[model samples]
Target: MRRERVRRPSGAVPPSPFVRRGRPAGAQQDTEADPARAGTMGSKQIAQETFDEAVQENITEFEMEPEEAVREAVLQFESQGVDLSNIVKAVRPPASENGQRQKHQILLTLESLAGAVAERDAARLPQPLAALAAQCREQLALRCLAGRHGAYPAVLSACQLAAGDRQLLLQALAALAALLDGQPDLLDAAGRELLLRSLREQQDAEVTLAGIRCVRHACLKHEHNRQAFVQGGVLPVLTGAIARHGSAAELVRTAASALRVMTFDDDIRVPFGHAHDHAKMIVLENDGLRVLIEAAKAFTDNSAVLSELCATLSRLSVRNEFCQEIVDLGGLNFMVTLLADCMEHPDVVRQVLGAIRAVAGNDDVKDAIVEAGATELIVLAISHHLGQPQICEQGCAALCMLALRKPENCSVIMEGGGALAALQAMRAHPREVAVQKQACMLIRNLVSRSRELCGPILALGAEGLIAEARAAHRDCDDVARAALRDLGCKVELRELWTGQKGGLAQ
Candidate 1:
């Protein structure tokens, strides 16, 4: 299966807690006093009527010009605690020439919101500011907002200041996550520190989930950020979240995905990456294997969370001992059972096969998996999902690993119709390079040790499929040819140049 990044749903912003309050008793009484001003107390009409009255008064009573009247009206509203931030205080321009003006207006609004967040003593965001922040759900808007001076720091400061209020804190963290989604460089030192602090200190599930998402986005494909986070002890925070919130499916899923991203070396800007080192750190220092395995027990029925946990386990199984550690912790049995139970879910089956394939890297684990009756289940899954190239590929690759060095396991695979399942996969996904290659390797490994099984496998039309794979994909050349040769079929073994003592071969 392809490793996909965990993404928030589109247009998903935190819920705003700042609702418009109803008119106060005094304002209602004022509205009641004048029937002409009815229902205008707390609506937009109130602001317009109030502004027009002030402007008219300024012109008639103070003998002010039109521009002076407008200025005086704005000042009067400001003095009366009316928010004119979103109001157009100048003369209206024609629509044809208003593009740049509209852009400037938007930037001004964003700046006002950011300034509100930056205030240290501000207890909570007002309705307009909170809603505006939530509107930054797209990349362009995020980039635009992030470009403004102090935008990132403002959101981070809001998170810090709103620590006492759960609703306000969630809004700020969600806004912060959106701001840092694809812009990893925007996470400066203070932003990074604030994110770590939030993850470490926050106990609310919603806040923790949002903070974990921020960590994932901040560290994705950014070598410097990944290393910094690891050094700052992010591994424990992630594992601890998993341990603490095993019942919270979304929390476990996001935290597991965050852990998986830490093992990625996908950044192109850096020549060499620390993916292997980070995986080792997660396994050795953080007890990741145990944590994840134990956490998986709580999510037996949740396919999405189980898929994430399984994929993460596959990523962390780098070393032989790590693979063995999974078995020692009873992870192998859990995966096998999960596969059998979730066979109907192609996604879960694919990830379980991958995790099993990863742990089968150890020789002993190979025998143990077979002993656990995985061979039959694997072939059954492959036969069940032949049309899904991901499932077929993972299944075939998994059987290939199980049959790598053990002839006894090869016998078991052949007995369970493993060869037939692989052939079906090859035929099902002819254009899929990974499926074709893995099937070819499975055929080669199956007959590599047991020559007697060659006739039965070749009888299932393995030769033509092998040759077809060899003809179709360049990557399947060696494996396909080896499978052909080992099945006692004639293959043209290419000899480019003879290693003659002289110089060249004609």
Candidate 2:
């Protein structure tokens, strides 16, 4: 027959102060404490029975540590035949402090829950880890808004309990981060102050990365935290992470995201306005742009990485201060180089175009891009996406930005065969009313600046121009009506007033 051994610790004690159940069935020799009850054996027996019942009912609740609870919850999730949607909730003591439930208790419960979900054993997770993530997200939002119950440590611990299950944990952390991002005031002054300091002090890359992820979400959700981030030296730490720990993709991405978030804030941007020189000097000192440029260059074949890097660059390109830094880091040259090499990836091309438009606003920069042969590429992209109005619009805007300041380069545009393409794009794709609109807008830009610039567009044959406008007028788009209005009287009146002898059309 199989035998089971009871595994009680040698020094373990029973629940009640009135009755001691530690003694084995017959080992109760310490009867001196109950002087009056020493002789009354039935009373101790009755009290011991009640204590055993209470202990059995509340076994898991009063015995487990917060972290351990988190682990158990995750384990339960990983256990066989567990239903995640229906997590077993543990009962705790009623709220005693300030008439409100304590955050630590809630945190412990959640920690246990997250731990159970993160457990890797092939037992079917009771509910999709997504559900737990959702709950944590909701709790995080509550905590951020007005709960003093839990702090970042609690959230951080819960996330840690989810370690090893990167995907689910990432989502959970992201949701929590999003809430914190929305509510920076949720962090106490000490928490706010420690955000960067602790990150700097931590030698572990993972810890630092996690902190950055938190900051990224916080900045994404709150404007005040954004300022706090900048003040707390988030950029410097991010730069450090990128440079020293490039191998940690999450860290790299998180750091990049932090920079991206900072760049999105107008309040953040405005403070460093015309300090382009100073910004350039400070940022360039650490080779910040070089770091970002390297990330962009290395991620050429990685679409996901490319998209993220491009997003980061797009954000960085917005501030003139940062823009100057980009230029100093050879970003203009690097992007122009990428445009030359990777024109096939449309998304990458789109990002390149945006970055170009951002920094090339200056005269010297525009001239440099033209000298470097960017106009042909820009014009080509515009031509290729003639059917995609938005891309064409960006292309045209870029072209206008390029040539508007440098009318001398009008010939470069025309020489590159951009004029005919632009005019044809305007005329051929009436289905994309917006594209047609942009085409006309570009034609207007060309004509408004230089009448000679009209020669190439006019060379597309006047018949097509009038037909295109007429077709636009007949279309359903309001943009079509505006195109007709701009082209009809605007072009013909100029021709007639100039006595150029080009009536409506032959």
Candidate 3:
């Protein structure tokens, strides 16, 4: 079955694949001799207009052909020490019969190669297809246009027809990934099967990595494709990739990221998606939690891969049993050490904190996290990176989870100055609604079970901050009000209705 196309909202302009650099067309040019422009002129690259002007001069005055004139213009600019990296130094051919720019030569060549590969013998795949695939991999606009022109089946056909020729197979897979990057709906059933087959059967690390990349791009924002791959038993292949290639960091990282993307319900078109079910399958049926936790042992020194693994662990912790399972598998201790060791790396610390928070959904794991000395480390991480809003948000959230339902953990947070750190985060990131809300929620969780801690929290002017959050963000009203009420601050609790015999209480 074909995936349905998602339509953009009315009047919404599609994003251009090309990045326009340098001065815009018809903008006034600054001369190098201008006193104000001297310092900047040396760093500026040659604009397209200037390059075209020189080419015209070479053609008109020197009587050079267009192609030779273009070549001479490039040499002239290079001799003058002018950077020509951004200029498209080519002779502009006449427009086609339609009076528009011709289709990119690379895309035209890809189309031709697609037909040639399809018509050739199934046993002998042409080598030029691999060459064209390499070219398409470099240009995103060409990849996007190729997808629009129905290039997916041809590429998948090339991958299938490669017939164990590893290099050609790898290039074909890379081309498929580029085409599916933002155009995920182009991934049809045959493409999904090929992706799964490559990941499951291929023992080559490069081919496995390429197939994992294809899966990631295919599942990015397309819920339909995600479900299709999951139904095709991609979970086991993804987890097996890490186990099979344990020492390959790049392969493991890409596989972990692809697994995480399967649990994302980001596509608005598919409202009632199976993201939560997929997470459950990855953890419960496929033993994903244990696989990922064991994989973490190999990458203790690699902060980036560890961060991704931790993030995926958080995504897969969808149940109380999963949370407790992570702890039983020694995830909690590893996370605490990661937090303490990677204190200087904010990204790792943030994801580790998030994982801690997710697993802390289990009440016993909450106490375990605190006992591992994670509470103090979390507070210190927050204090160290007060300038980063994401760290502050995740740190506060982790503390909030640890303090939930366990008053003793609340005492630890207060002793570690968790309250003070959260309030400082709230104050530092006044414009960030997430920081404000999470800090407020932490306050309420801190003081919810222990009323006496409210005095110190209120003494830090939390009432004003919570009230400001309630006033500024509509979503924060209930939580902020609960915080205020628990802190012994007088807040207006409006009663919208009462149990009365009339039709409605107005």
Candidate 4:
């Protein structure tokens, strides 16, 4: 008797030998449902299948869970009577109250493997190497969770292994990192290649972290690291990470470091918001500055990176040859926009103020920063409810710096109604005594540098000025004494009190 065949509820039917051998009319649609199988069976299937098979075989050996593999490997090493206590001792973090160090246990196992690998002791190495790679992969996976402490130590252990069993160890680390972690550490070609050669196998978020961190550290240590980044096929990878993994703090820091490295030379500087002008020498614009500018503007997860970039840009702006780029990138406008939104981030404000100070050293940039309402913002910052003493101090110093560059900015400060605020701050509180001293010094500088700045200082009224001078003189504070001398008090004004000389006209 003939029996009806069972079909999948989704309407899939079993394929006959002939149907599998030859493509049916609707075979393409059916195959599309199982993408992997369909690709292997299609026209390009021969090459695709070969490639996929190789990848799967590699992953099978390398992409296993790392922590378990490492523990097992360590136990196996100990079963063979290997002593790893000393290696563990060198790398152990400070012991806690319980005296039970879980990390030390893992580290001891990995270090044992590393030592065996380094000594070319094959019997002691293989199992531990395999376990180390697996632990790296497991740690990488854990990055999705909040606690990621054990990752770096594992990587260092793997790197040690890579130094010995070049082929086995390095390949193991790369496979594990690629599959399990997007960490910045293991992304560089040299680092990845090194890892790929020595590591047994595993994954880690730290692989990405390692790659970026290696590149960054190299840049910090010497110029050769920068060349390595360019030659290692890592730049595109790092830049791509920034675009796609913008949320990762490690990735963002890596991108900034890479950009900074490339920006060292004038030819590459144009890509990072800087260039060279015939007249002014260096100029950066649009995307060049925008990467960092956008980073600074993000203001949420990566504000530290933003602050660093801002400080770097500020330094660049102050270089006489680089001022043109600052102008071209709409820096003045950006600075103003940040002032309105970034009141909570004092570091950002400090950076913006510094950049302003740099660019504003030139008359045109100064006017632009001021015109962008920097003067008004400075006044607002001085009186912010948070009432940061440093903000007032910096505000006073920035005005002094601005007044030195453009006498008109001091007038803008006065017009923005900061004069009374500056005066009030001079005696705000005991904690604000330092700020008060800065205010008095700034007014003195304004009056001494140009009579025009004195117009506003005097506009605050003579009685208040005399009271400030008396406070400075009688307070026994060094800052107050210096400020008293700086207020343009003539010897005639001093000697009249002593009666050694006739009183001058009022």
Candidate 5:
């Protein structure tokens, strides 16, 4: 393949990678007249010109192996963070031309780079190799995006083992993944397919980690990418990635990060489209939560690992049946036990409390939870993390959910000093509407009847706080007003009835 170039006029400054948009090539002006500075700038420009010329010679000349010369040119381009866009465009075969020779040359170059990655797959790259690999990655990313010699599709095809030498397949796939990211419009389906395949079948932790990284980037800023991932069965592969490394923390962390992203989206499938949530069911039956539990246990000392595991579980516990699945998997008990053991770590406590709230929100689940002594843990979490409004909100919401129609649940809260916990949360976070609302709702449900639990709420003087915070939760003001009504004060219902007359009532 030959690279084309236009001859420059006299004294015309050549384009360098250091050239910025507004700054013309070699337009640098320095006020300082120091000879040292002038010498430095001159040396840099000379060195850059020397490097560019050498790269051009490598690409245009056929003296060396075509693949080796192309690889060397890429390394030179990457050393200075150079932009090969113009050079690539200048040299690329025309679309109308049947340039099989040029395309073949491009494929050879890709295979060479991929084989390098494979050579270093089993262990960390040495400094020199790591530098070369980083440069290779940066160059490949640019080349993939530049559409060189039909490079995009070629790179995509290289993901398959049968594309060429089987030894280089995983490396090629991994390299392609680093390029597929931030390109959802182009790579959503194809990228996800490649990633899922790599994660499920590769069995190499490096390949799985690479796939996990791609999954994170593909899902960035695109809902369609997430749908594509689920549609392509990313969850099953993710579980495979989690268990693939046999306790390698780096691989586990990467896989866990991918799981964290997978569960981050609140809407995995359309609500009314399927009764069973086929995608979620896939995750559940694959023992996804069980894998999370294992990760949480295996990485008890890693705050990041514990945090991601708890976050994934918290998201799963949003739905009713999933909450039960969490309990069945011992997730609820596991989280409470984690809180008891790691209260000093705020991140763990925050996620654990969030998960606990999500799991212990139903009538039956709350009963089992309170019976299992989660009520005390909830109160303790509230007390320990009062400065964390999210923790307080989840704790208070759990209390409200627990006491909804079960006075026995309210009795549990009262006996466990959860009423005081709610009061402390209200006082500490007076400005947080969520905390105030849940705290008020819990108190209202408690005093809604005489379950021998109203005394503690009344004794704590929660009525005024609940009433004052009524406007914070217009959606559930009835609960607040009812608590006031129960305290010998039938709060006005005029606004509650007629407030909807206005457009903003909703």
Candidate 6:
């Protein structure tokens, strides 16, 4: 028989306080103090007798006699009303003869249980399976903590290599995900190499998709996984997935999601909006933008994938150089069309708006946005999310970014009612710092260059918006003052807010 795997630390299998049973007998747990124990021996003896009867009854079927019986028994564990604790107690009595294969047998049971769970209905997992899963997960975590390099490959070889084993693969992936949920450290060098290797070299879409899901779980909001993925060259695989799986929405979604995670740590500058130049340049060099845009267009029906793709585009568009590239690749038009088609998903709209906000930073990209019917889209978006502070903030920022220093674009803004929307948002939500700032920024951009823009700016009640902003937010007041100075109307602004008469004529 294969040497028994090392035992987990005491209490490791149960792992949490919620478990009552279903742990491997190998995991020795400390007994808990009873809160309501009666001093009556009669009740205690009767409880013990009932338990004995239950154990004796389950012992017959819990026998792992023929290997096929073992498989059949685990598969039946879910369907029959067999108490999982009973199953363990009945079978564990033969430890001297069975201890060698106890852990292995449990693993097989879990593996089979996972397949059954996936292949069967999944609304609610049975209690036994859940408890057993927790035990297996805790056991694997203990192994990972020991720095056992073989643990990862063991899980991988068992499930990932089983071709056409969808249910087995799903369980294996779930186990890997559970192991690394908040424990990025468990992904040591060898484990990282194995995961990265799988992502890079796997030809099977199922394997690659699972690998990327693991990558998403690992890298999402975790700094360690991001660096490991980047260092291990996971990008080519991500882009390659997008390239090959143009039709498979899930594959595209997973790949795009992974790529989005990889670019998360681009915030190199503090108190500033821009990321490191190299962050977006890497995506540009890797042809990620085109790949993502293509995938997004192809899978327009897949909201999750499309949303991540838009977010990735927005992230990449943070720098001006990438902004130009996004424009060159017709990304602006894609976003406009996407927003027009899919307005029901707020997340999708939010990301698309964020990308537009970033892209509009390039004054040159402003014309493309206009040509792509972006102004109408923003007007609709603001209308869609009227009371939502971030949407209004982002819409105002995009409008102001697009309105700055472009004479015709100012007319476009005015005609599109984009300026009216920003002023209204400012009045509607004066307390939101982001809204006030973006409103002020938009107003500042509007009145900065064109003397003609001032008539429309003043007509939109911007003077009153400025006065209210001055009292509500100091930064907004500062920007409003700058906007007044830019428009040669600070004196009017001061007079209006001070309640003084003889403010300069509009």
lDDT of 2 by residue, 1-506 (tens): 22232323445544322221222333232212221122233332222222222232233433545444444443433342222221223333445668764332444445454455456422322232334334446543233322233334444444544445544445445544544644454554555555576567665676677567778766653456666666666677778778777666667777876777665543332344322332343255555667877766655555545546555665555455666666666777777777767766677677777767777666667777788889999888877766666666567666766776467676787788766776666665656665555555555555555566555565676336645655655442343333334333342222327656676766
**Least accurate 10 contiguous residues by lDDT in model 1:** 28-37
Error of 5 at 252 (Å): 3.6
| Model 1 TM | 0.76
**Runs in model 1 with CA error above 4 Å?**
1-100, 104-109, 118-151, 496-498, 501-506
Q: Model 5 misses residue 307 by how many Å?
A: 2.7
Best by lDDT: 3
How far residue 302's Cα lies from its native spot in candidate 1, in Å, is: 1.8
Name the candidate, 1 or 2, with the larger lDDT value: 1
CA-lDDT, candidates in order: 0.79, 0.55, 0.80, 0.49, 0.61, 0.63
Pull out the clashing pairs in model 3: none
Clashes of each: 0, 19, 0, 49, 0, 0
Per-model TM values vs. the true structure: 0.76, 0.55, 0.78, 0.47, 0.61, 0.64
Per-residue lDDT tens digits for candidate 1, residues 1-506, read: 32332322324444222111221112211111211122233432223333444455455556667787678667655654554533335432213554442233334546776667656556546543465455555434334433444567667777777777778877777877776666677787787788888889988888999999889988987888899998888999999999988889999999999999999997777898888998999999989999999998888788899889999999999999999999999999989998999999999999999999999999999999999999999999999998999999999999999999889999999999999999999999999999999999999998888999999998999999999999999999999989999999999998877877697558
- Which wins on TM-score, candidate 1 or candidate 3? 3
Write model 5 residue lDDT over 116-208, tens digit each, in one string: 335533232122222322433554333332333333454455554333334455455554555544343446356567667666666666656
> Model 4 over residues 101-149: C-alpha lDDT tens digits?
3343445555575576457565565566556545444543223111123
TM-score of candidate 5 on Cα atoms, chains taken together = 0.61
In candidate 3, what are the lDDT values of residues 376-494, reduced to their tens digit?
99999999999999999999999999999889999999999999999999889988999999999999999999998999888988999999989999888999999999999999997
Best by TM-score: 3
> How good is model 2 by TM-score?
0.55
Distance from true location, Cα of 460 in model 4, Å:
5.9
